[model samples]
Target: EAMLLSLYDHACFVLGHLEWSEGMRGNHYLACIAGLSVAAAYFPACRWTAQLRRWCAEQLRIEARYQFLPDGGNFEASIAYHRFSAEMLGWATWFLNRTPEGHNILGRDREFWLLLERITTFTEQTTYRSGVAPQIGDNDSGRFVSFLPLADDAESYGTWHADPHPYLSQRNHRETCALLRAVCRNEEHILDALFDDQTQHRQACFYAHTFGVAVLRNAEAEVFLRAGSIGQRGKGGHAHNDQLSITLALDGQEVIADPGTGIYLAQPAMRNRFRSTRMHSTLALDSVEQETWCEGGGEALFWLTSDRAHARIVAATERLIIAEHTAWHLPHRRVVRLEDGTLVIEDFFAAPSEATIWFHLHPHVRADRTGEGVRLEMPQAHAILTASGGATIMLEESLYSHSYGVWTPTRAIAIQPSGTRTQVTIRWQLRS
Candidate 1:
């Protein structure tokens, strides 16, 4: 319990800082409310009155932010996150009302009602079948954040359930319903049932569909990547430019990545460019990401953290897991692990690929060229990376994700491992 409070305190501190960041744009209602919720969490343990008062003032500034977005969607286009933000804000306001400090903050009840009305209308419209919120940016965030259960007995009038939606399932529907209840706040029926109905899912795999796959870690230390032939299904809005492209997480950080969707434009050209490999942690073959976002996408998967059991044969331990499919071919399972301060990668593909594999690091990681080797400088540590084969490139970065370091591929291949059935093998080991 003490540790949890400390974590909450840290989160409140971070949120307070972020709330003050220029990038936050104070107009982000949900984010501000999330900030308020974090602040509320700290009230029990916080002792600095001046800082607490400042936090309350910041929350008050954001009270009117939600009114700016007449449409109710977040700036990021994720309905589920928006709902989660709304619920958090609602609870924050309610909590404040019950406390002496909160009484001062919750003085303006009219603002809460307006924000709730707009948010509820927006949420009800986005609820599709299978209970899965649309697989959009930052869509998977709310799954891990816990909420104090609220009573929700209101009968949903116009909920839309999209059967067999690509990213949503029956369990997803339950969450959506729970959020609906929270928005309506019909206190008689506890909405915790919806959350209780399904065992919580970990944050490793976020969304995997026909064309694109995206995964995140509970620790936010590593990112796993894999893509397949499903990009042509008109889901590029949810797709990354990664084609069999995998991202890695090290020490709770991203060393290789797709920068993720930045902005939304009604134009197709703008959206298509964001989904290209240039933005992902994959090799740029002739500077191309996918052969047309539709041509020959293949399946990919990743495993996070070190699986020591698999580290003897290879120096890498997978922290993320991925499996993907290709055309005229069987499925492939790709395991990414971090072990003994090294990263090892193994691929189990059903077919042979003449294609040379490439690993691209995030452009932000600084690399030094020293003869035939590259030394990388990461946010937390540094590493020297080299390839064993002529066609492979290995680079290591001391990841900020955990206690150890992680190495990623910049150039390599998914080849048959030394005449073995396994198609690909790569390892990142530290020298003593």
Candidate 2:
């Protein structure tokens, strides 16, 4: 009890400092209040504990309402980070519900309870049946628990002995899902309503509109599309220039994949490369980034000029997702349709301009340039890609990071318009 009280005091001292910036408010704020709340509950009788509990109650309410959209998607926009923040909130939820004395009115906080249920749903929907998560934005591989402790004082506050994979791995994600399932209960069931891989709460399609992400899954494949605001109310600290990007997995193997975050501010050049527009599977204005301000620099490694992408999904359904963005002031639209192992992507530009479309593949997936676009092959699957609209196709060497600090060589397919065009269409047909 004494140790907990001492920890609470230190937590308060740190959290009491001048409010965090807008970008930090998303995950960092919720985590702070959650820690303080948990520590305060250890000895609820003390006057100091009472004060901490009240402060945490009010602060938690604000954090939940602001950081998580009604659709349960996190505004920070990184699935890995969402799991990190959810850990803090989930424990808070369970504690408040079970510990009657320390919750400080949170037991009856209807909004708090509702948000947890929603967050849980969104997290599950975004997670693949393989238990891997999409690297939509910056993924520093943050998580709630670790068995491996930081081994060296000079390792810069990281578990040097930790496994290469963080929240991005199947094992890590499953642990998180199990934790979430324990606290999130629903009084409903429809057989096969969710992913066939699970008995309950498995959804074939999930639209987190407020967060600009739409997911579609069938027996053979899962398609995830990004079309939404850069998170943190456009401050975009963890945001990526992935507006209109696509991540597709066929039969549990990634073909067109997002380059998972490799490292953070430590490697400024690598950091910028991983988040740059070219790194995503999307069209860019001849190499120009969706967020122009993020170009050509290493400083402010955590900052981005908000709203530059101005991307959003115009329409979405289980089979189709259509979204548009104005990167470099050129209006562009991408329409993606997926069904029965076949997919079509249509890129339309309002006016002609030099541009390129890149599709990064998983390291395990071999590829070769075809007369049209490229051919993609994984363990038990093969795909043929063909492009129209007068673009030369090229297969290039690239890098893919399954988790933080580990990278593997991969192949990337690029579609470069010979000159300029108003429209381009690429089709991927998958076969066993």
Best by lDDT: 2
lDDT of 1 at 110: 63
lDDT tens digits by residue: candidate 1, 200-240: 23344343332133444433234444543321122222334
Regions of model 2 farther than 4 Å from truth? 1-24, 102-104, 146-172, 186-200, 294-299, 350-353, 371-373, 418-432
lDDT of 2 by residue, 60-163 (tens): 77787888888887888777778888777766655544444435476667777788788888888877776667888877777755332222353321221123
Task: Pick the TM-score winner.
Answer: 2
- What lDDT does candidate 1 reach at residue 293? 42
Candidate 1 local accuracy as lDDT?
Answer: 0.40
* CA RMSD of all predictions: 18.5, 6.1
Poorest 10 consecutive residues by lDDT, candidate 2: 186-195
Clashes of each: 52, 4
